[model samples]
Target: MSENIIQIEHLNKSFGDVKAVSDLSIRVKEGELYAFLGVNGAGKSTTISIICGQLSKDSGKVIVSGRNIDDGMQDVTRALGVVFQNSALDMALNVRENLETRAALYGIKGEAFRKRLEELAEILDFKDILSRTVGKLSGGQRRRIDIARALLHKPRILILDEPTTGLDPQTRRLLWDVTEKLRRSEKMTVFLTTHYMEEAADADYVVILDSGKISAEGTPLELKNKYTGDFITLYGVTKQELDKIGLPMETVRDGVRIAVPNTAAATELIVRYPELFKDYEITKGKMDDVFLAVTGKKLVGGNEK
Candidate 1:
């Protein structure tokens, strides 16, 4: 999977007066977890819409598995699977019926389709609710069924547009675990967009979009290191110990932590008062720090929310 599975170039989109995406370009390597990080109205959905042929771009190119969406989408569509933010299941239909309907649409039939559903049911573990109405299931259960439906045809790449948005923490973790497992077993490229910085931290690569354009792009650790300062956690650092160091530190769990501008500051303090520093560890900045530094706003766009 050395080749780029999805590529976009000079992409532009608009809604009357607002420029949704401007000269946006991106490349997603095959079989990697690629995250698109942004807040609401950041064009994440618009980009997904264009990719899935739900909406058209005003200008530029999109290539999926070497096939352009404009040039007969059969090859491209066959290689992609998408689960939207909102539930797509027929609320009135049972889980099995919904899967069956979707499978038929994909032309998966007879023994093969039966076998396919069985396999998905085992991995996704929704057999208990298979005969129950989708509307009766919990949000997490519904999400699992939705994911099972998307993978029934076995697309090479899976795009989750804010898939875990409203889930509880436990449900989110469960979904994330299943997603990672599926990607590993199927070698499927996972592309997702989310406002959850914690969720984005797990991606192999991340690109933050603010106001529809790429604001920053890097691996999670790299982004944190580049945009924010280093911090140190000191064990056994006390008030008297702190006085000799002459550096401000916050007390925590019989220890202290300090944010230093650079390695030099940390090393200087450590060397100056070796006895004072019982044990010290330097850690890179967090994703939230990176977000604040880059956007000059909170991760959720300034407000506490």
Candidate 2:
């Protein structure tokens, strides 16, 4: 039987009157990458913190690698690696030195540490700037070093919080490519929480949290297929021009809105009318559309309290 590397059951946390995590349960199987998708303040970070022992849970229990997190905090933490949303690297230290210090903190030193460093550098393809100060590294390089530092301890499970946030499109794609390669090479279980729809779409399984609860759980395609109908994005010359078409559509920002029944309907419209709108796009279902359909909220984080 495959073991679950991380498990949380009926977890809850509160701050005065606010319930951060309520009745949350999640289990990540060994060697699988699980992505948590949610907006800000949806308890995704809070739940991860509890599992990592950074924050105490108000109720329920969390187990990491066969040991309860609260009862066996030391062993549980030792078996886990974390890459937070914010970079935790020391700007003053050189890249190698920063990793060396972190490796020592994990009780790894001497020849063992050196070998581990070499292994990580080779695996991560980070050879050119080992001696450079972290402050001088680009955002993507720093993020990679942070991930490498987490690996020095040789943890069984890795948790990344919004690993691609605040990066440009090219950088984001590069990071995702690196992450995919790492997953293939390391074969370690990974738990990632992010707001990026594309990133969530790439995960083997996604846990969608809404209003401090599990709103959806499935593979990316599964969630999209289950929740999303056909959608059409229409862009008209003017608002009145779009209104004149009179197709049922959901309004998006600026001059974009999605109409339903998707490709078939879109093709029918184009074939029959040919003059409804000057420009439009069509697709079966997307992560953003699924988010809207399931939560009744936009993926841009607006309309969310």
Candidate 3:
């Protein structure tokens, strides 16, 4: 079994009378994609801040890469690379200049810095934009630069706090592709917090927080099986035809949707009603459904609270 790179024990934090985190404990294994999911004000940011030593916890311990935060923040910081929701690059500086400035902070200049910059430029596909000012780059390009800056020192753990918020779908895919490549190539552990359900669906493990506490935790498949059901939508069929089939179904925009227990049940229905299911689509339970069923709120535009 892989060792736990990040471990929080009985963590608690508060702001005035508002409790931000309450007895939160989680284990993130090394080199795995661990997703931390929650709606707004659900203590996700608070927990991350505590782990990174940006905020002091009222009670409990936070260990990163096996080094307790209480021991020495310098050691803890060296093991982490954090990409915040907002851009951290210097707007007036070019991409290369911004990267060089950040590298100097970690004492990573000379030949080592050039090799690392070239590597990241290739991995993130930013070779063409090295001379572009940070302010002139698009949202996707800026996000990639933010990641590259954070990764210059080769930290063991990468913390992405809503890394993709306003990018187009193509940019989102490209960012994910770069992240996956980095994870595999460097054996880096990724701690991600995002409002995108589809992105979290690809995580190795998911932890859903609700109101400063954990509401659910499991793999994507496990969560879907526990909280959602498969759906079969049949087009070109009316309520009468669905009634004649004797299956519980509801009217949808383009067709009637029926909830089935599993894939076998959906297959049985299709085979049993050949004519009725001429134009139908069977979809398994999705992360969006699992999120709604567990959290009692739907995500709107990937930013819903």
- Measured by TM-score, the strongest candidate is 1
Runs in model 2 deviating more than 4 A are 231-283, 301-305
Candidate 1 C-alpha lDDT tens digits along 9-70: 99999999999998899999988899998878888999999998889899999999888988
User: Tens digit of lDDT per residue, candidate 2, span 32-112?
Assistant: 889998889889889988988889999997989999977768898788889998888899999989999999988999999
Put the candidates in lDDT order, highest first. 3, 1, 2
User: TM-score of predicted model 3?
Assistant: 0.91
Question: Model 3 lDDT vs. the true structure?
Answer: 0.89
> How accurate locally is residue 186 in candidate 2, as Cα lDDT from 0 to 100?
69
How far in Å is the alpha carbon of 12 misplaced in model 3?
0.8
TM-score of each: 0.92, 0.81, 0.91
lDDT of 1: 0.86
Comparison by lDDT, 2 against 3, better one: 3
Q: What is the lDDT of residue 242 in candidate 2?
A: 58
Error of 2 at 38 (Å): 0.9
Off by over 4 Å in 3: 252-254, 263-281, 302-305
TM-score of 1: 0.92
**What is the clash count of model 2?**
0
**Candidate 1 all-Cα RMSD:** 2.2
